[model samples]
Target: MSSTAITADATLPDAQPSPTSASRSVAEVLVCLPAIAADALPTVLEAIASAFPGEAVLVASSDPPANASDWPSLELIPYSNARTGVGWVLAVGDYAAAAHLAVERDARAVILLGDDTAPIDAPLLRSLADSVRTKNIDLVLPRFTLGPNDALVNSGLLYPLSRALFGADIHFPLPIDAALSTRLAQRLATSTQRLMALNQGSSLLWPVSEAAAAGLSVREIPAADIAPPAPPQDDFNALFATVAVSLFADIDAKASFWQRARGLPKRPSGQASPPPIAAIEASSEIHSMIETFHLAQDNLQEVWSLVLPPQSRLALKKLSELSPDAFVMEPDLWARIVYDFTLAFHLRTLNRNHLLGAMTPLYLAWVASHLRTVSDDPGRAARAVEITASAFETEKSYIVSRWRWPDRFNP
Candidate 1:
C-alpha cells in the first residue's frame, strides 16, 4: 500500500477516490494504542514513522488527543470497556477494537501498545512488525528482561502453568506490547465478543493460550527491561487472587486441549538473560512470609482439607516445621499445590474467591522460599526458575489424572 496523509477520523475525501487512489491510503499496519497518554503519542508515532518509513501506517487510539489532527496518520476509534488503573496489558475491549479497526482498514498486521510507551523504541516496533510481516508468525509476544524479584507471580505460576499445559514456551504470556497477524486478531476478536456477551468484557484475554489452542505459530522477541504497572489495589492478596482465578478459568475452559499430550516448543537459543541485580538482605521479609504460611496452616486447615489431598497436606505440614533459615518449598511440592488448587477451582470445591484467597499464604510461602534460594547468588535465579518449570512439566500427569478422575481417594 502506498502512503498518504489522512485525517484522524480515518475518512476519505468528499470527492470519492478511485480504487487506485484508495489503495494508496490503505494501511499496511494498524498500530493500536489503547488509553495511551497524550504526551506519549509523539514518541509512539515517531517510532512507527521511523520503523516503517514509506509504509502506510494507521495509528488508532481509543481516546485520541485533541491535537491528533497534527498527526496525519492518526485514527480515532472507540474501545468499549476501557479500564483505568489496571496494569499496562491490553484489555479484552482493546483487542476487539483493534481487530475491528484492522479489518476496517484491511491491514496486514496489528501492533498493540500499552499505555506506557516510553520503553518502546523504534527498533522494538520494527522487530514486532517484521515478525508478523516477514516471519509470518501469527502471534508475536515480547520477552521482557525482568529482575529476579520482579513479576514473581508470573515466574512462580503463570509461566510454568502455561508452559506445561499449552506446550507454548513463551517467557511472558501476558505482555504489555505484542504484534498479531490479521488472522490471530480475528480469532481473539471472536473470543472477546463471546466474553462481552457473557458480561465478561473486562476480563483478561490469554492470547498465548488462544493461539496455542488454534494451532497458530507464536514467537517471542527480546525486549528491554520494561517494568509492569503496579496493582490497581494495595491489597496484594486480592491482586493475586484476581490473576489466579482468571488463569484457572482459562485452564478449565481448555481442559480438553491441555489434557492431550503435546510436545513443547523448543527453547530459542541465545535467550537474553536478566541483568545482574544487587542482592539485598530479606530475612525480615522472608520471616514475615513464612509466619503467614504457618498461621494459614494452623487456621485454614479446614479449608485446605477440602482442597489438598492427604499427601499434599502432609507435605505442607513438613514444610511448616522447617526453620526460617532453612525454609524451602520444593518445586515438586509447589507444583502439586498449584495443580490441586487448579483442580479445586475446576471442581468448585468451595467458593472460588475463598479457594483462591486461601491460596495466597501458600503462594507467599513459595515466594519466600524462592527469595532465599536465590538471595546469595542472584544469577542463579534463572536456573532456579527453569528447575521449577521442569518440575511442573514432570508432574503434568498428576494433574491430568486428577482432572480425569477427580477422586479424593488418591494418596
Candidate 2:
C-alpha cells in the first residue's frame, strides 16, 4: 500500500510516553488474534507488555480448539469452530466476533491482531489510540506495505479500487488489521446482525465503509512488518478472487445510477468513425493486459450484440484489441469501460468469486495503461486503480436505481 498523505500540524500531539511511564494514563488495549505460532508467542506478548505497561493489554484468541494459555497477557475466547464463508477465522464474521468481544469487556479501545502477525513499535499503537481519543476518530486503519516479495493482492486492486469508488480512504481496505473505538464497536454490533443475515458464517466485514458512511472521523496509521512475510499461494489466490468478485458484484448492483450520472453524450445524428489505438505502448504487461481485454471482448460479444448499437459494438471490439502499449485510451473508450462495468454491476451476474476473477485481468490492463502514462511505480499503479474505482462511485445513484430494477434501456 502507498504511504498516507498526512502532515502533522501543531495541533496534532505526539505519541505519549512508554506504557510503563508513570505519567501515562491506563488505556485498555484489546489484542484480537485467530491463532499464533507457539514459538513466536513469547516475543509477541513481551512486546505488548513492554509497549503498554501503563495500559492494561488484553489478548483474545479466537482460534479453534481454543489453545491460548501460555502467554501471561493472552486470554482465549472460545468460539465454535463451525465452517463459515471464504475467510472465516473463528465464529465467521470479523466485525461480529470483534464487536461481541469488545462489548463483553466494555473495552475503551480495540486492536485486531492476526495469527502470525507481528507487532509494530509502541508508538504506532500510541498513535492509533491518540487518533481515537484526541481527534474523536472512530476508526484507525493502518496502511499495509509489501514485506519483501510478499504482496497482498487486495493492496494492488481491491483496496485502491474500493477507496476510489466509495470515496473512502480505507488504508487496510479489508479486515486484515484494525482498531476500533468503543462506540464504533457498538455501531458495528448493530450491523453485525444485519451482516449475519445477509451472509452468515462469513468473515467479510466493512468496518471502514460502515464508519465512513456514518460520518465518523477516521485516520490512517502506517505499520511495518504486520502481516506474515509471505502468505501461502493458495491463500493469496483465494483472497484475491473473493475480493475481486465481491467488488464487481457491489458495482454491478449499483449500475443504473452510475450510467445515468455519467451523462453519456448522444451519438451524433450522422455516422461516426472508430477511434484508433495506434499510439498505445506495446510493453509486455500492457500486451498481456490487452490480450485479456480482447478476451473480455469475446465474452461480452453475446451480451453487447443484444444491447449495443451495431456501430458501437464494432467500435468497442476494435477498441478492446488496441495494444495497451500503443493505446491512448480516448475519452470515449474510458466512458465505455465505465459503462461496461456499470452493466456488470447492475446485473450482479458475477458473484463475488467470478466478479473478482473477471476484474483482475481487466485491472491489469488498466495498470498497463497507467504504467505507460506514469513511470510504473507500484504505488502510482495502485493510485491509478483508485481513480478507476472512483469512476464507478461517481454514478452511485444510477447504480442503486438500476440495481433495484434491471432494464437495458440506454440511460
Candidate 3:
C-alpha cells in the first residue's frame, strides 16, 4: 500500500506470458495513444506483439515531434481536433475519434493507452479480446499503478470515490487503460447526440456512463509494475476544474430525475436521464451485502441521519438487527438504494455540497450491495459498477424531475 515504491507484486516479473490462442480470433484489439512519448512505444508494441498477436492499431490523437522515428507495427491515425479546457486538459486527446477508427476497422475491442502506460501480459491483450469474443464483455480495464508512488490519484481517491458514488467499482474509471469491445466502440460512435447532451455544459465525456447504460459487460484486471509510459500530470487547479466542470455538467443533465426522486419540484421537459444499463446484483462472495450496509449505517448513524429520511433510518436500523444473511435479501433495501441515488442525484444538481457529503454513506451502502452481487467475479463486479455509472448518467434528469415535481410518493 506504500505509495513511495512499486511493490514486487505490482508487475508479473518472472511470469512468462503464455502464447495467445488462435481460436480467440473473433475479436481485434486496438491501443489508443497521444503520439508522443517514444520511449515507451517499443515496450508497448513488444508487449502487444507477444500478448495479442492480432492486428494492433494505434489511434494517434496528438502530433509526434518531428524528430521521432516511426515503426511498422504502429499505424498512426491522425485526429486533429483535440483540445484542452479552462482548468484541465482532456485526458485522452480525441478519444471519440480513436473509438470511431476502431469501429471502422471492425475491431472487437480497443485498448486506450496514455503516454505513460504499458501492457504486462501480451496474453492479457488476448484475454481481453477473448473475453469480448466469447463471454460477450463490453469493456475490460486493468488495475493500474501510477509510477512507484502508487499515487492516490488512481486508487485511494478516484477508484473508491467512483465505487461509492456509483455503486460499481471501476478502478481506472477516468483513465485510459485496457480494452473496449467492438459493441462498446460502436455504442460510443453512435451516441454522439447523447454524448453531446451530457457534455453540453461541460468539457468532459463520460464514456463509462455510456458503456454501462448500454448494458455492455465490463470488467477490470490486475496489471501491476509493467512500467507504464509517462503522463503529463496536471496541477491541482487544473484537476479541480476538470472534476468540477464534469461533475456539474452531470448534475445538470440529471436535474429533473434528481428532483423527482428527492421529492423536490420538477424542472422543464427538455431535460432527460442519460440512459439506463443492466441491473447489478450482489456478488456471491459473501452471503449478504445488506448486512455490511447495515453495519456501516449503524457506525455512521450521525452522518446517515443528516441526509436520510426518518423512515429510511428506521428501515435500515430494523434491517441491521436481522442476521447478515437476511439483511440485503430484503426487497425494500434494494429499493432504497435506487431511490436514495435518485434523491442524491437531485441534491447534487442543487449544488448542495453539505447534502452531497451527507449522501456519501447511503451511496456507500449501495456500493456494498453491488459488491455483494459481483463478489464472485472481479470483472463482473467492475462491470456492475460501470452499469451503475450508466444508470447514474441517465438518471441525471431525475434531479430535474424532482425539482419540478415534489410529490413524496411515500407520504
Clashes of each: 0, 28, 55
User: Relative to the unseen true structure, what is the C-alpha lDDT of residue 198 in candidate 1, on a scale of 0 to 100?
Assistant: 58
Number of backbone clashes in candidate 1: 0
Which ranges in model 1 have alpha carbons more than 4 Å from their true place?
1-24, 65-81, 265-282, 376-378, 408-411
User: Best candidate, lDDT-wise?
Assistant: 1
When summed lDDT is taken over every stretch of 10 residues in candidate 3, the lowest stretch is: 1-10
What lDDT would each prediction earn against the true structure? 0.76, 0.52, 0.47
233-349: candidate 1 lDDT, tens digit per residue: 677877787789889999999999999947575354333232232355558889999999999999999999999898989999999999887788888899999999999999999
What C-alpha lDDT, on a 0 to 100 scale, does residue 245 get in candidate 1?
88
lDDT of 2 at 220: 77
> What TM-score, computed on C-alpha atoms, does each candidate reach?
0.87, 0.67, 0.49
Quote the positional error of residue 403 for candidate 1 in Å: 0.2
Which has the better lDDT: candidate 2, or candidate 3? 2
- The Cα error of candidate 3 at residue 333, in Å, is 16
Instruction: Give the alpha carbon lDDT tens digit for every residue of 1-411 in model 2.
Output: 111221222111112121333533243666665456666656666666666665556665433222345444444344322234453222325556556656655667777654245544566666776676667778887765643223434544455444544455664556555788888887776765554555553545556556755666667777655553333345644766655555554544433322333332333433233322234346775677677767877895654444344555676666676655555443244434434554554455444345445555544555455556444355544444444344434444443544455464443
